[model samples]
Each structure stands twice: as structure tokens, then as C-alpha cells.
Target: MKAARFHAARDIRVEDVPAPGAPGPTQVLVKNQFCGICGTDLHEYLGGPIFIPTAPHSYTGGQVPQILGHEYSGVVEAVGSQVTSVKPGDRVSIQPMVSPRDDYYGRRGQYQLSEQLAIIGLSHPWGGMAEYSLVEDYNAIPMPDDLSTEHAALIEPTAVTVYATHRGGVKPGDSVLVAGAGPIGQLQVMAARAAGATRIFLVDLNDNRLEMAHRLVEGLITLNPGSTDVLREVRARTAGGVGVDVAFECVGAEAPLGLCLEAVRRQGVVVQVGMQGKPPALDGFTLTYKDVDLRGSWCYSTLMWPQVAALIASGQLPAEKVVTRHIALDDVVEQGFEALLDKAGTQLKILIEL
Candidate 1:
């Protein structure tokens, strides 16, 4: 088996490793076919050692000497006796959250927020950036035969967007604004539109990204915040300062997040879908004055994976359009992660084909 391991920040290598055996009673063994490097993976590569929950990792519970990839898809090589959801040769994508059975949060449908949660890429012995992965049966969702591995590899991130947009209560006929044009931001655009948001605005400083956003979204408008005030432009297009009815903050930067805070109309919802490096500052008075709902979204509910998969299978969301590049497992270091650092013009999801 060959695995891409994260030894520390700025370090990832594909090395020959042990092949996992057949499943345990509650587990399944998957031979991976495709994996995607995500923004979180970039954070772990650059600024982290952050959230693995073991003390032996005084620096990182296991970021170093860790198998690092979560967004992926594969075929089940074997399944344990207790695994009723899937079987041998079944193509599947994993939902990477772990939870304690006794936890009240897990029982409440908020497993994404469970205190005992451990992400597969960060805490497990093997994750998707490998030739094989061992995951619990509950984590594996069988993929429709028509779904390509690249699109299947995207189900995880697409699940995140689906979860967040639903949490924001986005509806048809609502004018929506996505305050960023990164991969997640662009997905936010697609997700918002799919969820019935009629008029959508994608705001960003990068004209290249905005252009890409425009290309991915058929009728959605792209707004250049650098050239003109974004709020003004969206409103001018929308007819008044009542502004967009809903906003999604997808860059994780205060500039875009703050713009989301100010741009949604009174009573509109603002969903925070990106990971912020720092706490964003907000005027508490605005919440009281505007009577708006500004909430943060973490990952998705396990229940959401089926719909996400269906969206991909149906081509309604066109998940493949987001895949800007494909690389072999060996080239993730430069082409997937590092390229994201310097890329513009034409890049979105970068998938590693195993």
C-alpha cells in the first residue's frame, strides 16, 4: 500500500505503507480511487497541528506522522459482518466524523458538534490519502454506479455546502450573495442557486475567481468588490438597499464575512460557511437593529450525505464543474496544495487520482 503521510507542517509524502486487512465487526475496508485536497488540508500543511484530540501529540495529536485526506471515494474491498449498509465491491464515499454513542449531542442529530468527534484525516490510523482506508460502516455511503470517482470524491465537500445552505434557510425567489469566490465560495454560489435562490451574487477581489464563478454559475452575477463597492452593485442590480435576502460568508476572512454581516437585508439570514483563522469582529448593535440571523455552520449532518450524493448523481449540482485539476497521489504536494497557494485564473477542486 502507498500512503500520503503528513509528518509536520509543509511536509507530506507518498510512501509505501501496510495494507489494511478485512473489516472488523463494525468496520469496512476500502481501496481508495480518488481523494481531494481541501482548504483544511492546506491549513494543516501550512499553519497547523491544531485539532487532533490526543495528548501524546503535544504539538499535534497526530498531524505529523498522520495520514491526511478526508474528501475521497473508493470501493469496498471487504465489510465486517455487522456492516449492513454496504458490501464487497460497493463504491462508497465516507462521512468523516466520529462520535461517542453515549453523547447527548450525537443523539440529538448534531453529531457534527459532538464533543468526542475526531476527523478521519486528523485522528485515524488511515484516511483517504492512501491505497486503503478502514472506516466504520456508518461512515460509508454507497455511490451510484453512474457517478465518476472524481465526482464521488467531491460528495464530502458538497455535503458541507448542502448542510450550510439548508441551515441558512435559503429559499426560491430570494436574492442571495456569496461573499467570496474560492472553491467553497463558488460551491456556495451553486448550492444557493440549487436551493431556489433566484438572484445570486458572487463577490470577490480576484477577477479571475469571479470570472470562474461566473462560468460555473449560468445566470448568477459576479461582483468585483475591488473595482466597485460590492454592496452598491448588488443593490443596484436588486433595486434597493433592502439588499440580498441571504448571504453566505465563504472566504473565512473578516472582509468578506463582515460584508456578509452588512449586506443582508433586515431579517435576512447570514451563514458562515468557511473556517475563520481569527474571530471576526462584529457590532453587537447591528444584530439588535437589523433583527437578522447570523449563524456559523460547521460540517454536515450524517443524514445529509444521501442528498448530497443524489445531487451529484443527478447532475443537478454539476459537482464535476468544480474540479479544476486532477493529479496522481504522488503530486499532491505541489500540484494540489502548493498550486492552490499560487493559483488563479482557472482552479477550483483539485482531486488526487489514486
Candidate 2:
């Protein structure tokens, strides 16, 4: 099978590799259909061995040279005897988390936070970029026939946005301020709208991204923070000298993180949805005096996958329109990597169709 394997920074190459070994008792073999390139993948490819705790020899799954995709959908080609949730020929979206189902976290329904967690494609034997991927039955969520593989591939990332929005507790009448308009940020806006945010303010330096955000959602007021003072504008627009009810920080950079803290109302919720390369300074004085609630969110749970899938299928959430471009597996370099890196905020989601 031909898989795009990451060797070093700016050094991903497609290589012919052996197919996945036979499924384990709880495993299922899925024929790859669609995979989404993620920001973490970009970070790893640009400058990383990334995070492989056990190494020396590495892997596409459960190891390094990691096939490196967590967002994807595939068809079940076969399954081991113990796989009862999905049978041969079933269409499923991969959840990608490896956790003991009977463990304390699993029993308490927070398996995403379990100590034994290992993500597929990141730490497994095979990933969706290859012809087939090996995943445990528990990681396979059956996507409905109404959902396309393109949309099914979205469940993973959309799940992240959904979880973050839910964590922020955006209510129907609340106002939201989103710090970035990247793919995740756009999804975060959509999730905020669904959760009942009446007004949304998106701040990004790029006009292209702000325009995309304006066209994507109705009644979203955007700001080019490069030209205007976003904090000043937000304060002027909202009642009192303070800002929005909820502020979602979607860019990991220092400026955006700082602005998120400055833009929210006193005692408002601020969820840090982005991963920063370096730690940004916190406003200890503001937190001490103003009582701002700062929270960090990670990836979503299995329970949220079904809801994300339903949102996409129902078209209440415009995940499909967010796809800026689609490329074949062979052209991932030109269409996926360089274009994304070079253009940055200009493009939204880029898809790899199998």
C-alpha cells in the first residue's frame, strides 16, 4: 500500500508499505476513503518527531512515521470475530481513540481523558491515508447512509469544535467573540450559533478569512484587527465597557490569546480551544479582580461524534461548504502541504479524497 509517511520536517514522502496485519480479536479493517489534513499534522511534518513515547522502531499506528491522521471515514472491509458493532461492508467513521472500555474513565464516560489513551494514525499500526487502517471495534462509529464520506471525514474535527463550544456554554441569547477564522474557528462559530449565540464577532488579520466567515454564517460581524482595534470595537459594540458573554480563543498565538482575555465581559467564560507552541502570559490581576473563567478544551468524546455527524447530515451545520479544496492522494504535497502553509488563513478545510 502507498502511504504518505513523515520522516522529518518538510520531509513527508509517499512510500509503498506492507498492508496492515490481520485484525486482532477486537479490531476491524477499514478501506480508506477520505482523510482530513490537520494543524497538528502540519506542526509534526514541519518540525517534529512529534510525540512518540515508545520508539527506536516506529509505526503508522501505535508508533511514529505515524500515518498521521485522526480525521477520516472508511468502509469496513473486514472485522475480527469479536467485532460485533460493525460487520463487513458497513460504512463507519473512525473515532481514533484507544482506551480500555471497562476502565474507570470509560465507566464514568470520560474515556477521552484516560491515561491509557493512544490515538489511531498517531500511535497505531495503520491510518486512513493508507489503503486500509486497523482499528478496534470500539473506535468505529457507524455513520448514517445520508452522510457522505467527505462529511463523515469531518466528524473528528467538528467533534472538537462542538465539544469546545459546549464547554464554553454559549447560550441562545449570548454574544460570542471568536479569535480566529481558520477551519476550526469557523466550525467553532457554527457551533456557537447552534448553541444559541445571537451575535458573533470574529477577529482575524486576513480579509479573505473574515470574508469567508461573513459569507459562511449569517449575522456574524467580523473585524480585521490588523487595521482596527478589536478590543476597542468590541467594547463599543457591547453594553458596558466590557465585551462579549463568551470568548473562544481559536489561534494559539500570543496576540489572539491576549485579545481573548481582554475582549470578554467580566466573569464571562473564555475557552482556549487552540494549542500554543509557547505558553502565553495569563492576566493574574484580571482573574483576581474581574473573576474571569478560563478553561482549556481537548478533543471530543464518542458521544459527541454522533451529534456532529447528525449536524452535518442535517445541513444545519455547513461543514461541506467549509471545504476550500479537495485533492487526490498522490497530490497531497502540492495541494495539501505547500498550499496550506503558503496561503495560511486564505483557505479553510482541504480534503484528501481516496
Candidate 1: residue 77 lDDT (0-100):
90
- For candidate 1, what is the lDDT? 0.82
Candidate 2 has a TM-score of: 0.95
Pairs in clash, predicted candidate 2: 59-64, 61-123, 61-124, 61-125, 62-123, 62-124, 63-123, 172-196
* Window of ten residues with lowest summed lDDT in model 1: 53-62
lDDT of 1 by residue, 151-207 (tens): 888988888888888989988878898887887888778888788888899888888
Question: Model 1 clash pairs?
Answer: none
Predicted structure 1, TM vs. truth:
0.95
Write one digit per residue (lDDT tens) for candidate 2, span 1-354.
Answer: 888777677877878888888898988989989998887778877778675434732322255576767789999988998888999888899998777767789888898887777777666666777778888888888989899877899888888888998889888789899998888888888888878888789988888888888766788989988899898889888877678999999988888877888888999888999998888888778765768899898888777778999998997787876788988878888788777787556667888887
